[model samples]
Target chain A: MDVLLTSTAEAFRLLFSGNPEIWEIVGISFRVSSMAILAAVPPALVIAFTLAYGSFPGRRFLISLFNTFLSVPAVVIGLTLFIILSRQGPMGDFKLLFTQTAMGLGQFFLCLPILVCMAHVSLQAADRAAWETARTLGANRLRAFFTVLYEIRFGLTAALLAGYGRIISEVGASMMLGGNIAHYTRNIPTAIALETSKGAFAEGIALGIVLLFLAFVLNSLLQYVQGKGSINP
Target chain B: MIENFRIGFREISKSFGSNQVLEQTAISIASHDCIVITGNNGAGKTTLLRIIAGLEKPGHCEISLDDASPEPWRRLRKRLLKSVMYLHQQPYMFAGSLLRNIEYAARLNPALADRESSVQKAVSWAGLEGLESQSAASLSGGQKQRVALTRARLCHPQVLLLDEPTANLDSESRERTLQMLREFRDSGTAIVIVTHDPGVFSDLATSKLHLQDHRIQADDIGAADVVELDSVRQSKKR
Candidate 1:
């Protein structure tokens, strides 16, 4: 108990004392994760919208496939990308094996399914009348699509927050793809792992606090957005 | 004001899986026309209206405009979408102020030179004054229906297809909706209304049709009361 308390206290000290190294790892995590989620959102929304609204062959199969991807372990994705991006692999021409771009690529795949599946669920729960109403009101198909999106804006925001939370906190993918290099590719989760393994409990605990605080903030945001949309849902 | 025009949709066929909802049914709408359609639930009354509005894909259909040569429905669908508007049984209000709802329709109408005044006038025309800033989604059934008409009023669609415009309204709301509809028809906007209570629209309905056997037929006025309920159920079973 004393050890835990001591490390936790020192962790806050390091966090608030303008620790450059700790903040750099935090910056890498956010930059990679933010770019990944931003890149994943548009394509995920299109896929989810197609699954929810379009009627075509294999649509149901595609929906099921995405839902299945939601449960896939992050390590599995990390390993798959690692092979594909390795020196001898098909994509090896890029030579992006142990870089921030690799970490971003891993996180992108990790969050794509999450955004797709969750957005699909939100669109499914949306009122069909929204689409019909927009069409009848002289909106073209594209305008009508945007109208429906606006109707379910709160739900989509929730999906976005959930996707960001999952990718940012994931350790396995960042560690495997980013290689946990000191100040270059290192992120919060990778740094936590390295610090803990080196018996540097204070550093690990500080990073854990950041993750925990982030989880709390994201969940609070989710709850607030859900409350705004609870009536529609 | 809408331009004087006529549209004839021939051979509208729509099916959901094995269920044949509409089978080569036909209908026509001309300027200043009020066509009322009556049928039991699942008789595809709404489907026919939707097809006329170009909001649904038909198995096959053809459209002829103003004595012109017949063209495939797929070809004329864009024209129909531009000129026709369909109102739902329970009107859906966008997620914002009532003013925003009216503003949306005004924005779609490129011909409207002054959108601000046009929208304001429409709000007053629908008796929706003092409620401009309120969330439209929170309005009562009657208020929502009025807002829908207000939107229709702004766009000036050549044809308006409404599904049960007075389904659950009290007498006051029904009267308000009928008054607005009467003005729409007078302004040369063709009106197609699908209702269980066709009697309410008796004054304005220029023609009445019954949906039966997956077809639209000129309704025999007295015969409908006796044969409608049983025949509709029988047709569903077929």
Candidate 2:
């Protein structure tokens, strides 16, 4: 406990001093997660709308398949991508292993199911009248689709927040696929893991503090977008 | 009857699982005419209107305009969407102001010139002058109806399918709605209004249809009759 107390104080000092290592890690974390979400959102929305409103063969089967995938463990996803990116695996020709892109690819898959599941629920709960009304108002399929999407914009925003939250703090895929290389792919969560294993609790504590702050900032932004947070600041 | 357009529906049917609604039904609507559809609750009146509006596809059905008959439903799909507009019992508002809802339809129509003026005219025509900037969700029932009417008017569809438009309105609102329908009819828009209130539609209906037992029966209400048949039926208690 005494060690923990001193280490926490040192962590605060490192954080307040604008440590370069901490900043680099935080920046990498943000870049990878943001890119992954950007890649995931469009496809997630398309899949979700198709599942919710479309009438086609195997729709029920596809929905059930996605629902089953919703519970897939993150470590399982990391392992699956690890093999796929490895030299002996099917996708090894690209040699994307141990790169930021590989980690991002894993994170993209992780975020997609969350987005599709939540957005599908949101679209299902939406008023059917909106779609029919848009159609009858002389909107073709494309125009009516956009109108329905607008009606559910708030829910879409929430889906994005949830997806971002899921990927930003994830450590498993980043460590495995990114190799946690310092100055290249080391993110906050990976740095915290490395520091804690090495008994450098100050760096670990410092990275943990930054990660917590990141979570706070993300949640604050989300609440503000949802019209639930303080506007004073 | 107008030669250029006539809405034809043939042998349309629909069901939800084991429960059937419309079963092998047909109807034809001409331009500048008003048809009142009447039935008891769950008698498929709304379903028929939905099929006519092309919002719901019939189980075994075909529809067309003019004399394009026998499997012309495929051809009807394209024209059905352009020439028909449906008004729900409780109309839905797009996510913005009243003006946006009207202009949304106007934007899609390539022929609507002076979009802003067209929206303004629709608003004023519906007697909704000052509520332009308000969110459509905040409007009263009658105001919502008028907004929906304004949307339909801006689209300028040749056929309008209304499902229980006056079901929830007050007497004054109902009268205002009927008056608007009269005006639209005068401007040569074919209207198929579904209502249980016979008094509201008596004067405007060129014909009356009653759906019962999954079949459409043309009622004996004469074109000149103005009696409230629904009210009289209600007093007799079935």
Candidate 3:
């Protein structure tokens, strides 16, 4: 307990002192994860909307496929991406292995199912009249789609936060794809893993604290948006 | 001041798996026309209107415009959707304020040069004077109906299709809605209303049609005869 308390206190000191190394890891984590989510959101929303509103054969199979992917272990995703991005594999020609781009790609695939499933649920819950009303009001197909999306903006925001949280905190994919190189590819989860394995608990704890803080901020924003959506005021 | 326009949908049919909703339903609409359609529950009145508004894909349908050759519904659906508007039984107010809902419609309409003033005028015309900033979803049913009409007015659709526009309104609200419909018809917008209570629309309906057994039985009474019939019905009610 004494050691834990001392390490936690030291972690705070390191955080507040603005240590360049620790902050660099934090920045890389955010940059990679932000790019991943930004790349994933549009396609995820389109897939979710199509699943919710489109009438086509195999749609049920596609939805079930996504739902199944929602539970896939992160390490499995890392291994699969590692194989594909490594030399002697189909996409190895891109030379993307052990790079931040590769890490972002892994994170993008990891969060896509999450965003699609959650957005699909939200779209299903929205009123059908919202789409019809927009069309009748002279909006084209794309405009009507956006109008419905705005109607369910709060729910979609929650989905986005959830997807970001999952990808940002995930360790296996980032570790395997990024190789955790210092100053270039090392991120929060990977750094925490390396630090703790080396018995450097203070750095690990500090990084852990950042993840926890992010989770708190994201969940708080989600709850506030949900309250605004459900409550009249 | 509106240009002469007419739409005729012929050989319209729709089926939901084993249940046939509408079959070979036909209707003709023109500018300055008010068509009130009445039918029993599950008689496909709303389905027919939706088919005309291009909101639903019929089994097979053809559309004719202003004495032109009839074409497949698919070919003319885009034009129909642009010019036609359909209102729900319980009108849906969008997420924002009443004024925002009106403004959304006005923004889509190219004819409205000044969207803000047009929306304001529509709000006042719908008798929704003070509820501009209030969330539209919080409005009463009658208020939602009026907001839907106000949006329709702002868009200036060539055909306005309404499904049970006054289903749950009080007498005063019902009278207000009927008055608005009369004004829409007078402005040369083709109005098509599907309702269970056709008597309420007696004054506004240029033609009364009944939906029965997957077909529209149109009662093509002359304008003077319809006025006389309305007076007799009103006197009988009193």
B-chain TM-score, every candidate?
Answer: 0.91, 0.88, 0.91
lDDT of 3 by residue, A1-233 (tens): 99899999999999999999999999999999999999999999999999999999999999999999999999899999999999987999999999999999999999999999999999999999999999989999999999999999998999999999999999999999999999999999999999999999999999999999999999999999999887655
**Global lDDT of model 2:** 0.83
Give the interface RMSD values of the models in order: 0.7, 0.9, 0.5
What TM-score does model 2 achieve against the real structure?
0.91
**Deviating ranges (above 4 Å) for candidate 2:** A225-233, B1-4, B72-75, B221-238
List the DockQ of the predictions in order.
Answer: 0.64, 0.68, 0.82
The digit string of per-residue lDDT tens for model 1 on B87-110 reads 988999999999999999899889
lDDT per model, in order? 0.89, 0.83, 0.90
* Count of backbone clashes, every candidate in sequence: 0, 0, 0
Q: For residues B59-176, write the lDDT of model 2, one tens digit per residue.
A: 8887654666556555567567778899999999987788888788778777878988887888899999888899787888988998888888888889898988898899899899
lDDT of 1 by residue, A95-127 (tens): 998999999999999999989998898889888
Question: Mind giving the per-residue lDDT tens digits that candidate 3 earns over B1-238?
Answer: 4677878888889998988988887787887777788889999888888888889989999989988999999999889889999999988878988888988998899988888888888888998999999989889999999999999898888999999999889999998998998888888898888988888888787778778888877555433332123433234234
- Ranked by TM-score from best down, the candidates are 3, 1, 2
Best prediction by lDDT: 3
Ranking of predictions according to lDDT: 3, 1, 2
TM-score of each: 0.95, 0.91, 0.95
Model 1 regions more than 4 Å off: B221-238
Error of 3 at A165 (Å): 0.6
